[model samples]
Target: MLDARREDLGRMLRAWRMARDPAALPGPVPFRGHRTYLTQLDMALLLGVSERWYRALERGEDRGYAREMIDGVARILALPPRQATALYRGTGHQPPRRPAGGVRPDAALLDLLHQQRRVSWICDQAWDVLAVNAVGARHCPWLARADANVMTWAFSAEARYQLRDWEARWAGSLLGRLRLAWQRWPDNARLDEVVRGVRREPGVAELWERTADTRETSDDAARPMYFPLVAPDPVDVRVAAYGRFGDTALRWLVLTPEDPTVAFP
Candidate 1:
């Protein structure tokens, strides 16, 4: 039973991570592979501690890393504000509250979201890839053009190829975002289902046990992130866009490439 709950928490963590927007996080862009722009050693510096001790915290070996330390990590990871608070309070012990709504996209918003440059979509707080624009279809091969779960893309073999730095960068960022979405609108059944689906993957399952503290602060200068474009270049092409609430009932998201030279064509 403990193991089951651990897995459930892991899934919730995974879902939450996928829902975050890097622009909302803090810190400079990190070299790929470090968690939320900080290495275990960097975390030590942030905590005024040492790498070996920080490694223990990361390994889940420390029974008591100060609330401040956990919060520090969450901030570094750019966890959605609520998730960060909850994480600090819970000491990495809780999963997000279950989401309440189903995955539904507004028709007009869908049209607009697709019309944008790259690819974008809408999912209720559950992290499902409820919808995607043509650019998403064209660029993000790992994500299903039809009903999809961002978590699926995170865990898929294709995702590793597409994301390149899945463990440190994409996985943590995505999960942190997803958690924020859940915080904003928990009790969404569709989001829960998506969370469950992605938790089945091994790498995701492993990371979920640690904590939901993963941040990625993307500045205006930074770009949207995408993958599977012309290969040889490992970093997924950067894409950017924002979610605009058309009304209480609908949201519009536009995904566009950060680099104008790299046209969608």
Candidate 2:
């Protein structure tokens, strides 16, 4: 039975890989340097494993690949969430738990994000910027990037200028939030990758080592956050986050100007 399962998984993976158009995968389109279907070599490269290792798995000669590797393969193939979950189960590995709330935002949430007056955006538990209003994009240009992630921006060189108090206001708070997320999804490869990138920064690494037990406190009293904008003085805004009810793994963040009379452009 084990042998049969491995063979079936290998065949399925091969078919999935062959069916995808290299030009149509998500994110930035790869340069069409060569006309080819996503090959075994491509899968190997994407998963950071050798072609031989991937071939062995595909040939039903190896069924010892870790869950992370299986997941990495699923992502590279752009498998739908359900198919990915099925693949994990078919391979005799447990799939990662879905976010408590859900995966995709509902119509109402989308409408709210589109129509909100304030700078509002929705991010997943991984801090992946899913949807952002025009106001939110205008205030924080980084939110519009292909790899728009809160943790990535916080430790970037640009953060030094964009965030008024990087250490006190941003870094510590972001790290604490990430810690909470880690507690919930400890096996998340993307989250682990973000932390690894952060640790490369000396200052953030020190803070992460020191604040293992620290939990970030919410600022409900409308504490001011300064952002360098077009105005002569830095813009003062108050940020708040609301988790979506039910099984949606989404959070809405609103950034309102500190001065109620002043509206966001």
- How well is each residue in 1-265 modelled by candidate 2, as lDDT tens digits? 3388778878987998898776543322223455557888877765667889989888877557776577667655767767777678776688766522235566777777778777788887777666677677777766755346777777888876777666766676677778778778787766776777777875777788887866556544344454444455656677778776664367888887777776766
Judging by lDDT against the true structure, name the best candidate: 2
Clashing pairs in 2: 101-247, 101-248, 102-247, 102-248, 102-249
The window of 10 residues in a row where model 2 has the poorest summed lDDT is 24-33
Residue-level lDDT tens digits of model 1 in 1-265 = 2344434444544455444443322211223343432345544554456778766554435356664455445544446556554555445544334321233555566666656665565544444445555565566643333234566666778767656566755666667665666566555655665677777877677777664674556522333244536334543344343454543333344444445556665
The numbered model that scores best in TM-score is 2
lDDT of each: 0.51, 0.69
Q: How does each model score on TM-score?
A: 0.50, 0.59
Q: Could you tally the backbone clashes for each prediction?
A: 32, 5
